[model samples]
Target: MDFLELVKKRRSVRAYQNKSIPDRELSKILEAARLAPSGFNAQAYKIIVIKDEKSREKLGELAKQPYISKAPIILAAVNTKLDDKYSPLDIAIALDHIMLAAAELGIGTVFVGAYHNEEIRDFVGAPNTAEMVALMPLGYPADKEIAKKRKEISELISQEKF
Candidate 1:
């Protein structure tokens, strides 16, 4: 699909099939994140790929969404540099790239942030200086096309000056 179509097709998939993602596809997704532009090229972030069921269960317990544990894979995006002023922005862009790449590869992903930070930090073995940005559960979607609700252009766009 084209870029626009890919964007439109992307959805926050919460339900997934009981299957594993191939290493090739996962590598491609991570490559997208690695290639994403960062402020000053400081790519101050790291991704912890979670595949162990026990760890996924621990993470799911810390998160509001228990369904996350059902996914075959989970990616924990982390900002590796606490001193980097634009770490959050950098991670956001990287995560966006990952999601878009996954969409193009016919994989499903969802951004999950509501979780116990301390527990996640320990589970991922992140340093005390780093920050846990978000968790993304990935796999093949189990259901049909997901419907989306979007605001009209008029409500979102603005003129040169407010």
Candidate 2:
């Protein structure tokens, strides 16, 4: 599919099937994240792949989103350079790449931003130098319906000045 179509098809999946993503597809998703651009090429981030059911359960509980544990994998995007102001943006871009890649492969994902930071960081064993920025749950989508209402291009774009 074309990039625009792919982008349109990408949605925040909340329900997922009990299925595992193939290694090939998973590799592609991770590769997309790895290739994401960062400010000044400082890719100060790390993606912690969580596949253990117990850990996912704990994370889901901490996030107060039980649906999170339903997915087969949960990717934790971490900013490794806490001192760098752009680290969070870099991590967000990487996560976006992962979401797009997964959508292309017929997989589903959701960007999870609400959660207990310190608890999750400690549970995932992330170093003190790193901070968890976001969590993404990935798997075959159990809910296929997409009902996205977006703003028109005219309403979203502006001329030289606002």
Candidate 3:
């Protein structure tokens, strides 16, 4: 599919099928994140791939989003550079790459931002210096039909200034 079509097809998949993503597909998704650009080329981040059923369940509970547990994998984006202002942005770009790659591979993903950060960090065994920026659940989507909703481009941009 073309890039624009891919972008349009990408959706925040909440309902996932009970199927495992192939290792090669997972690798491609991670590779996309690995190639994401970072400030000063300092890719100070780590992606924790959670596959254990119990861990996924606990993470869902911590995030107060039980649906997250349905996916076969949960990726936690961690910023290793707490003092660097660009750390969060770098992680966000990486996560976006992961999401787009997963969508292209017929895998589904959802960006999860609201969660018990400290607990999640501890659960993932991340050091105190690291901060868990976001969580993403990945799997084959159970619901294929997603309604795309967005504002007009005119409402989102200006000629030269905001």
Rate residue 22 of model 2 by lDDT.
89
lDDT of 2 by residue, 4-51 (tens): 999988999989998899889999999999999999999998899999
Quick one: best lDDT, which candidate? 3
Candidate 2 local distance difference test against the native:
0.89
Output the better candidate (2/3) by lDDT.
Answer: 3
**Each prediction's TM-score versus the true structure:** 0.95, 0.95, 0.96
Model 2: residues >4 Å from true position, as ranges? 114-116
lDDT of 3 by residue, 6-99 (tens): 9888899999999998899999999999999999999999999999999999999998899999999999988889889998999999999999
Task: Evaluate model 3: give its TM-score.
Answer: 0.96
> Could you tell me how far off, in angstroms, the CA of residue 49 lies in candidate 3 after the best superposition?
0.6
Name model 1 segments beyond 4 Å from true: 114-116
Candidate 1 backbone overlaps, count: 0
Q: After superposition, how far is residue 120 of candidate 1 from its true place, in Å?
A: 0.5
lDDT of 2 at 61: 93
